[model samples]
Target chain A: MKNNVKKLSDYIDRLNWEKAPGAAECGELENLYAAVRRVKSLKPPVMPGADFPDKVVQSLARGIKRAKSRKRLLKSAAAAAAVLAVALLVYFAALKDTNIVSAMERAYGRVSAYHGTLEVVFTSGAGERQVQSVLDVWADKQGRYAIGVLEGAYQGLMTVSDGEKVWQSPPGEGALMPVFSETHEFIFELGGEIEALKAAQSARVAGEETVAGRPAYVLEVTPQGGLPYKLWVDKETKIPLQKEGAMHNAIQYTTRYIEITFAESIPDELIQVEGKNFREADIGEEESPAPAGESPDEAFEPQVRVEVDMQAEQAQQIAADSGSSPWRLDPVFTAQVFVSLQISPEGITGEYPVDYEDFTIARTDGRRMKVQVSSDKTEIKAVYLERLVRQDETGIWTVVGYDISR
Target chain B: MNEEGLKFAAEVCRQTWEPLYRYVYHKVQNREEAEDITQETYIRSLAYPKFREIGRAEYLAFFKAVAANLVKDRWRRNKKRGIQVGFDAAANLAFTEDPAEAVGERMLVEQALKTLSAEQRKVVELRIIRGYSVSETARMMGLKAGHVRVLQYRALKNLAVILSKEETSHEE
Candidate 1:
C-alpha cells in the first residue's frame, strides 16, 4: 500500500495525471489521486464583494491626503531657513549682473506671445537623431499662458492656462484634461519671473552673436544648482532670438532654440478648447459614501476636514516606500531638475522629465482627494479617478471642474 | 504615487488580485479573511516607495510574499482552535451526506493548490488543469523538463503536507 502511494505521487509529479494504477492498484492511493483531481477541477471564486475596488481606491486617497499634509508641514518649517540663505546669496550676486539681467528681463517681459522652431540633436546607439518641432507660445502679464507642440511624437499636445484653470491636451487623447492651478505655475511660465532671475547663480554677457540672421547679445545665465544656459537677446527688439544649453549634467545633450518671435494679442481659440464632445476624467479620488442629510448630488462634493501635519522624515519614508523622490513634491522649481528638453550636439534628442511631478493632493473633499502635479516647464498632469459627464460620442469636450473639491 | 505609478499599480491590482486572493483564501479558508489579507497586501505595498520602479513579475512576487506571510500569521493565530473532526470521518460524512459537502471538501483541496509559488502554480495549471504533457508544459513555461519535474514534485509534496494536516488534526 505504501509503495502504491509512492508510485501514485511519483507518477503525478511526472505530469501523468491521467495514468491509472496497474491491475493490482491500492484503493487508498487511487482515492487520493481522485480527490486531487476533483480539487483541481474546481475553479476559484471571483472576489467576494463589489466594494473591494472602491474600498482600495478610498484607502489610497486617504493615504495620499495623509502624505500631502505631512509634506506641507515639513516644507513650511524648512522654507524660512532655506529662503534666508537663498536671499543672502541672491543679494550678493545681484550686484554683479544687474545690467545683463535687466536687459534679458525686459526682453522677455514685453512678449505676449511667440512663435519659434525648436531643433534638437542627440546621440543614440545608431548615431545621431535630429528632431525639429515648431514652438508656439502665448503669455499674458497676468500669468496666463498657452503652449502648442506642433511637431514630433508630441506634435498635437497642448497646454493652456486661464490663470485659475489649467487645461491640457495629451498626445492622442482628443479630450482636454483640467488640472490644478499650481500645475501651470510650475510648467508653462518660462524664465520671465523676476524671482527666477534673482535665483540665478551668475549672469554675464557672453558675447554678440547672430541667431537666424539676427544680431543678438548672448547672455549666459546660470541658476543656483542648475545648468548654465545662454540666451541670445535680439539686438534690435531686445526679444530673445535663441536659447542654448545642456539639459542635464549626467547626459551630454545640448538643446538650442533655433527661432523665436513675440506676438500681440494671441487669439483666444488657440489656448481654450471650445466644443461639447470631450469626456473628462478625474484620476485621484474614489467615490465615497454620502454624508447624512444630504442628497447624493450634494454629497458628491467632498467636504474638507482637518489637515494632518507631516514631517520630512515621514515624507521621506513615504517617498522611499513609493520608490519616488521627495523633492518631486516640493513647490520650489529648481531649473536643472525641471528643464524640459535634451538635445545632443550630434542632434539625437528627447524630451526631459517625461512625466509630471510625483503625486500630490491638489484638493480634497471630505470624501475624495484629487491628485495633480505640475511639470517643471513643459507639462501638467492629473490622474483622473472619476468619469465626468460629456455631451458627445467622439468624446471631444471634456471639461474638468477647476473648483476645489470642498 | 504619481499618475504613472498609480496607473501601474491599478494595472497590477487588476491582473493579480484574483490569484493573490485565491492563494490567501486557500491557506486562511475564509472568504472575508482572504479579502482582508488581499487588501492588506495592497495597502502594505503602498509603502514600497518605488512601486513603479519594479517590473510586473517582481511586483507580483513581492505581493505573493506579503500574502503568504499574512496567511502564516493567520494560521499561528488559529492554531489553538483544535481539530473539529477526524479526516476519515469527515471524508465519510462528505460522501454520505449532501454532494455539496463534497464540493466544499474539494474547495479545501483547491485552496491547498494556491500555496504553490507562481512558477509551481504555472506548472500545475499547465500540466494538470490544461492537460499538457511534461515536455509541452516545460516548453510553454520556458523551463527545462527536469526543472518542471522538480517543481511538480515540490508542489505535490506541499499539497500532500496540507492534506496530511487534515488527517493529523483528526488523530488529535
Candidate 2:
C-alpha cells in the first residue's frame, strides 16, 4: 500500500506539462498508463439520476459562492454599461470577419433536418496504412437523432434519442439501456462550432474545393492565440462539407461528409429503436437513495437519514458486538455489496467494518444526524436505511456521504 | 466583466455544462471532484480578459484547457490551451474544440476494446473501467488474484498495440 502511494505520487510528479508528454511516454509503466487512462473518463458511461443536475447546480453555487455576492453588487450597478458593452461587442464582432462565417453559420443553421455520413480518416507516419471510422447520422429539427456505427469494433453499437429519452445498445446482443436525462452527456448541437468560430480573430476564404459532388469554398479560421483550421462550405448552400485539421499535438485527421442529402423532414423511426426493449435505469428505481432527503427520482440531497438508538451507547447504537450498518433493511443491498448488514436482529455482523467518516450526531431526537460508510465498503454506493430501526425520526442521523472512491 | 457580459458568460457556461462536466468527470473519475472542477473551469474561463469577445469554440477550448489544468493540478494544474501553444507536435492541436476530440477518442477506445479476447476484455472492464479491487475482480471473474493481475497486464498490452495502430489522438 505504501509503495502504491509512492508509485502514484512519482507517476504524478513525473507528468510534466512543460514537456507535454503523452501517457505513451510513461516508459515501462504500462500499469500506470492503463490506470491513468481509465481515470481519464473511459468508464462505461452511466446515466445520471434525475436530480443529478440539481445537485451539480447546488455544487456549482457552492464552488463560486465566495465571490458571488460581491459580483452581484457590482453587476447590478453596471447594468447600463453592460448593455453598451454587449452592443459594442456585437458591432465589432459583426465587422471583423462577416461574410463566409456568417454565411456558413446561416447555411448550417437554416436547414431543419438532414442526413449525412461523417468519415474520419487517420494516416500513420509511413502513410502505408490508414484506418477509418464511419458514422451513419440522422437528425431532425426537433432534437431527435440516431447514430449508428457503420465501421469499427463497435460496428453494431447504436445510440438513439427519441426527444424524450436516450437509449444505447452495446456492441453485441443486449437490451437497450436508458440514459437518464441528468446523465445524458452529448448534445450534438450540429453547428455549435460555427458560433465558436464567431469569436475567432481571423476567418478568411482561402480557396475552393469539390466536396460531396458540390463546389465549396474552403475557409481558414484561426481563433485568438490558437492554431488555424480549414472548413469546406458548399458554395450554393453554405453548409459545412468537411473539416480537416490537427486538433492537438499536431496529430492529423480529415473528417468529411462522404454522403449527404438535404431533406424536408426526417422520420421518427430513424431517431428511435422502434421494436427494442430498453432496460430500466436502476437509479431511484429500487435502490435506496441517501438516507435523509430520500426522493424517488433524485440524488439531489447530500444527506439521507439513518436511525440509531439515541439513549444507547454509540457503538451499541450503530451495531451489535460485531458491527454493521442500517442498510440491513433491503435485499438489494446484498446484491451490490458483499457485506450483509443484517445478522440476527443485532444489526451488522463481525464482517461490517465501521470506523466511521460520519460520526454520531449531537442533535436532539427527530433532528438530522450525520451517517456514512467506512472505507472498507466503498462499493455499496446508494443504500438508504429505509425506515430506521425505531421509526418516528427520533435519533435519526443523516447520511452525510463519503468519497466512496477506492 | 460588465453585467451583460457576465450574463452572456453564464449562458455560455450553462450551454456547455454537460460536456464540460463529462470531460472533467472522465479526468478525475469522481463525481464531487468533477463537479467542483467543472464549475471552476467555467469560473476561470469567465475570468479571462474580455470574456465577451471569445467565441463559443474558443470558450469551450478555454474551459477544456482549464479542466485539463485542474486535472493536472490534482495529478501534479495553469496554462490554457491556445495561450501556451508549445512548439512540440502536441501543441498544434490544442485549440480545436475538445468535446469533439473527447467523443472521437471514446469511440476509438471502445472500438479497440472489441479486439481483445473476451477474458482479456472483461479483465480490463472490471479492473480498470469499473475500478474494482483486484480481489473483487478475481471473485467476480472466478479467478485467483494472481491470475487476475496477469490478465490485467496482458489486456493493457493488447490495448496499447491496437490503439497505436489506429492512433489519431493528439495528447497534451
RMSDs, each prediction? 30.3, 24.5
Residue-level lDDT of model 1, residues A219-274, one tens digit each, is: 78776654566666667666655545443323323334444445685577765665
Residue A294 CA displacement from its true place in model 1, Å = 34
State the lDDT of candidate 2 residue by residue for A3-81, as single tens digits.
4433433332222111112233234454455444653356543334556555545444544453455566466757758
Candidate 1 TM-score, C-alpha based: 0.30
- State the iRMSD of every prediction, in order shown: 16.9, 10.7
**Alpha carbon deviation, residue B140, candidate 2 (Å):** 3.7
Q: Write the per-residue lDDT of candidate 1 for residues B31-103, one digit (tens) a residue.
A: 5566777877776665455555555556665676666665545444434433221222222221222468656
Alpha-carbon DockQ of candidate 2: 0.06
Give the residue spans of candidate 1 off by over 4 A.
Answer: A1-98, A117-129, A132-134, A170-195, A247-257, A276-406, B1-172
The numbered model that scores best in lDDT is: 2
How well does candidate 1 score on lDDT at residue A55?
68
Model 2 gets an lDDT of: 0.51
